[model samples]
Target: MAAPVYQAPPMPTDAEIARDVRREKRGRIGGRGALYLAATAFALFAALPFAWMLLTVFKQNSDLYDPNLNPFLYNDPPTLQNIGYLFAQTEYATFIRNTLLVAVLVVVITLLAAVPAAYSLTRLAGRWGESLGIAIFLVYLVPPTLLFIPLSRVVADLGLRNSVWSLVVVYPSFTIPFCTWLLMGFFKSIPWDIEEQAMIDGYSRIGAIWRTVLPISIPGLLTVVVFSFALTMHEFVYALAFVTSSAQKTVSIGVTTELIRGDVYFWQSLMAAAALVAIPIALLYNAFLDRFIAGFTMGAVKG
Candidate 1:
């Protein structure tokens, strides 16, 4: 036979139980409502433009010309004709190739220039070295418009006129200064002891720089690569000033010169192509974004 039966606590009265349930429900509902509001607002702010582009890229010339269809709505059955025209009618492939060539090569040039300058500035740690680096960056602030005339002369003198590779050379003039300055700040943040110890060992100065200092500054180096490539990609004024030949035109000038027919803008496809362009840069940033922020933040504090 069972020795004893354990008694359970009685359930609360309905009024008390109902009040507790209502409190939890209210909290849950309030939280959900706030989340919904935030999401809706963000969609309006960030997503609306993309939504509009998606709608337009699919819209027919008839649909686009008509004032009736809503820009915000994508109910129009999608067509890929605008994109088709963009690829088929234009030298879009060539433009992309030209742009990529410059963007990739310029990163190489910027690194070579900025890294040495940065190392020198950091190691010297004197007023002269810092001032010299700052002065170099200040040169970049001079308006491209102002420099364009003189640059034209220089471009002609170098015999790089009307060539995309002209940009591969000229862009460094602008890119190097800023990237060098940025890296200078980052380089300064690393303790000298790291490099000093490497040298104190059997490692030569160059060997120590390669094995120790540069390796540890990977984040800063990547930052320079990203900035250098980005500046090269988006550069318009210099691209326009330097490149006059249609065959040599980068995506920036190519789109405007080839796509825009009078004031009647190809708004949809233009924006679509532009939206595509930013994808790689965004991916680069997202991939190494944490390190970039860390490098900058650390550099800023050290400065």
Candidate 2:
């Protein structure tokens, strides 16, 4: 007549539970390992062309045309003669000056114009402002071929055709819309409380924007600057379209047209020249890349 002895089911031991957790963790780590491997493969794919360019620049003329030369390794005696000849033979310096001037001017003008326009739209624009902004940037999304011809006539009317100032006028068509749209997003991300507090403290709307917002949006500004600079520097279609004079030509046009004579493509010298042209751009992007990504990503998300 004794009551049945009650017994509890045995719990899983610490080691057994730990083994299950470890198994899950290992699975996660293995997935991450595969992800890293995939990323590395993509990176290598992207970088191979650049590596070839670097190798080609240093390769001798004899080695350059040879499909037999080891691509990943240096041909027995690597030389700087190609790079040396590019500088010595071509009007490389003048081309560089023209490119720099156009790029800087575009960057300055874009920031000056776009920042104010964005601020106005965000602050003072009524209900239609958002629609207007989206619509305006869409105009920029239009292909260059459609607009460049009409733009040419306009440039001639302004007497900017065949002038370096032509790029100054032309680049903003693209830069301003994107920059304005980008700044709108960055401005939205900013807390309006600080701006309102500043206005309450006797700051004008413009003053509050300049002091409270701009200082925080340096990254966004640099993104616009980088875009403007790159567009002015690399856009051959407009450059070739606008400039015909040898003395007036920008580097992009000059390098592609003026560097080679006949079918005798100066492969080594051409690549060396291109690499030189590409270096500053590479530097600019790499230096400000973080800001550029943040600005563009924020813009795309909000927009």
Candidate 3:
């Protein structure tokens, strides 16, 4: 017992603790650096097509057509001729106008129909809401290719064929169902308490929805707008089937139909058209990206 010495165990010095902390800090910094590097790389990869389109927009025909020259660089002096041709030679402006008109109309129609339907399904339909919501979403999953033939017949019956109004009428069929389903998911995520509180405070159900619910669901509404607009803009099968006139065509149809002759491809003008349209849309999506993502993430859940 006497030989069992009472020796204190060694404790870490402040320097040692400081060194360990520095090592952990370095590890975290290294991880973040790797993450940043990967993000930048992916961003560059995603941006490659736009960059190529931008370069092609300014490239001369010689520069673009020469197979031997690098596609990413200019061999000849850069010119605005492609953009000039896109504006001056074709019905590009008309296409842009028609596209905007159809997209705006479709967005309006989708919001009007989807919001009320979604609200009713979420708040009033009770347990049957989920089943009905899925049924509505299934309607959206029906491929446009399958539906276009019948839709074409409908367009003919309605005297909307060969008209932009045809697209305005047709685009909402899909947009509304999909948007309603999406909005149902979003609405279900909202608490009943807030709505009940509003009602208790003398707001009608409609008034509560208009004032409290909708203002909180801006992300969902914007998501619907973006989806509806983008769908209208990029819808080619319906546009081609229902509309044929160059003046009535949207950008997706007009640029290809007008720019490409039987064999000849207007590469520069095509790229220019794509660039001008894609860039602005890309900017818009980026602007609302957080909200857009939040909406979709919440909407993927079944209501």
Q: Rank the candidates by lDDT, best first.
A: 3, 2, 1
The Cα error of candidate 1 at residue 282, in Å, is 1.6
Q: Can you tell me which runs of candidate 3 are displaced by over 4 Å?
A: 1-23
Q: What TM-score, to 2 decimals, does candidate 2 have?
A: 0.90
lDDT of each: 0.83, 0.84, 0.92
> CA shift at 107, candidate 3, in angstroms?
0.2
Query: Model 2 clash pairs?
Result: none
TM-score of each: 0.82, 0.90, 0.90
Q: What is residue 45's positional error in candidate 2, in angstroms?
A: 1.0
Candidate 3, overall lDDT? 0.92
User: Mind giving the per-residue lDDT tens digits that candidate 2 earns over 225-256?
Assistant: 88888887888888888887766778888777
Clashes of each: 0, 0, 0
Model 3 collision count: 0
Error of 2 at 226 (Å): 1.2
Tens digits of lDDT, candidate 1, 1-303: 977888888989999899999999999999999999999999799877766666677777776776787755554666787777778887777888899999989999888888998888868758788789879879989988898889889998999999998889888999898888888887787788988899999799899899988888898888888878888778899899899787898988887878898887887677656666766777888899999897777656763
The true-versus-predicted C-alpha distance at residue 131 of model 2, in Å, is 0.8
